[model samples]
Target: MFRFAVLLLALLFAAPAATQSLQAQYEAFLEGTIWPQAKLAGVSRKTFDGAMGAKRLNTDIPGLVTPGAKEPPRRMRQAEFSAPAKYFNERNIGYITATGRSLARKYASTLASIEKTYGVPARILLAIWGRESGFGRVDIPHDAFQVLGTKAFMSTRPELFRRELINALVIVQLGHASPSAMRSSWAGAMGQPQFLPSSYLQYAVDFDGNGHPDIWNSVPDTLASIAAYLKASGWVPGRDWGFEVTVPASVSCALEGPDRGKRISDWAKLGIRRVSGKPFPEHEARAEGFLLMPAGRHGPAFIATPNFYVIKEYNESDLYALFVGHAGDRIQWGDSRFSAGWDRTDSMLRSDIAKMQRALEGKGYDVGGADGLPGFKTRRSIGDWQEKNGRTPTCWPSNALISAIR
Candidate 1:
């Protein structure tokens, strides 16, 4: 019986590779299936192979790509949103702002043209440039083909990866970029603007009129490409990213996100006030927005607009969206004060946060139904509990709190 069990375990371990085949088969497929797609797309096979041969499947990276498997969200706050609001003050703002302004100057002409053409704000573009690549300080390491191939070979979304892998090969064949030059993020985001191969094909532009949309090496092309993507994703010029505001003493707002836009007048009528203490502009009085009290009622709050949602398309997570917004906000103005209150403390791990969400829901507080995220309701409950128990209000969760509520 023990021998049989050993054999069963061996087979279980071997079964996945048996199902997917090894890297050799993957290589042959690249030569066979992928090359044909490239030829049809006007790429030479020699160029395809030579450009791609520099790198190999990064088995480690594919671990980051599988979908529907149990893994953390790509980004999460290191602590409760309230904890950092105080530290994200004028001194830090000064440091980040200087960096942003310098990057803006470096990309000024390209930025101006991109803004004129795409309706994305220049400061926002500069902020992204500064943040993602450190104003081009960082160098890309892995060739994109290997990165894409590794993900394709191991991804839960095999169809998506396969398509992207083929697209990378096709780009090589088109002479748009060599395999060696296609180095980028391990997840296969490439170039100055950090575009996916598919996105590069779709939205990247040759702003210099240099005949190639050279995002990898050309500054103008990359900024323009970034701008183009933002425009397509619904960036509105001249509007602030959104305002940090305090919710009114009376209105019961719930589960509103940047995705849920409500007119500013309507939100104001409900008692939302700006953090800066001045009234919201009349022109934007009717611009729809959703209330997001990030640290609960005791923490900081914001009214995120459609443009806020646009930044999320650039990156999916709320924290990433906040980073982009706050970075831009800091660049535009110095040391903006907190809009809402916070009971600052360390954050729960994402998995813990998920468990806490379940606990909170069972206790009759709605925490947006536990998709492994902390949001308004979850934060609010933490705040309410802390307020009631003299714990000084924090958005983070604890197993002890769960035990108490139970």
Candidate 2:
């Protein structure tokens, strides 16, 4: 009985059946899928073969599973939604701002030229430069072809990575970058600006007139590329990203999201005032401003502009855009922090949040696909639910709320 039990255990844990091993699978994918795409993208056989011939798959990249393995559970139970306050740690922000100031002076001429050409502010470009790669001090360690190819062959989003892989080959074929020079992040974002290959192809600029947008080693190219990307993403010139504001109790925190935009003047009439005691710029008064309460009413709030949303196009996270804007303010104006404080809220596992989101969605509330993260949709839905249940709306998630909802 013991021997039979041991055999059953071994069988249960055994690897899935496959005609080809992982390495063989990777090689087959390269030849069958990758080569055809590369050819279609106009990459010569020499460049494609040279770049991919001996490259081995980096199977250890995060968010990967075996090709034929059972899909993992949708909810990441162990994932903790990090505290909003922690995202704006003074030490980290200070380091970025301080380093940004130094680089601002060091590359003043380059930045000035980039700003003139792209209509993006030097401070904003410098902030993104510092934030993305620590002003190129941080080393990008993976080979572009290797990272993208590996991800394409087996990662969760294979199609996306496959497209990126083809674009990388296109970059090489165009002689924009040699394969050896194409270092990237584990997720396959490349160079100082950390753009994916498609973005690189579209936005990278040869600022120094070197005939190639060498974002890897050229300061001018790196800064210019970032500016080009922002410019392409519709960064409004002469407009501020956002201003930290005090949202009066009368204004519902549930009124948060890009879709809920109103004129800056209208927002002011509703008693939302800048924390700095300054009025909204005359030009922006008639322009649309969206309420961005990242942590609902529990944390700092802002009246964000279209330009603010443009920054989010660089990175989807609200915190990320705020960090860039705040860091730029520090470098350009002076050291400043958000006037409002982030209140402590009860922590809950992302799985629980997802459960709450699904329940709300089933009730015809849009919590935005029941993802673990409590985005604007989730936050507002929570408030709407609260108001409907005769509870005061907090517009934020909490453990108590989860229990109540469940």
lDDT of 2 by residue, 246-355 (tens): 99888888999999999999999999999999999999988999999888878899999988889989988888888899899999999988888888777677778888
RMSD (Å) of each candidate, 1 decimal: 5.8, 2.9
Q: Write the per-residue lDDT of candidate 1 for residues 192-250, one digit (tens) a residue.
A: 78888889888989899988899878878877888889888988877777788877656
What lDDT would candidate 2 get against the real structure?
0.87
- Clashing residue pairs in candidate 1 (N, C-alpha, C atoms within 3 angstroms): 43-173, 262-288, 262-289, 263-288, 298-341, 299-340, 299-341
Candidate 2 error regions (>4 Å): 1-20, 68-71, 74-80
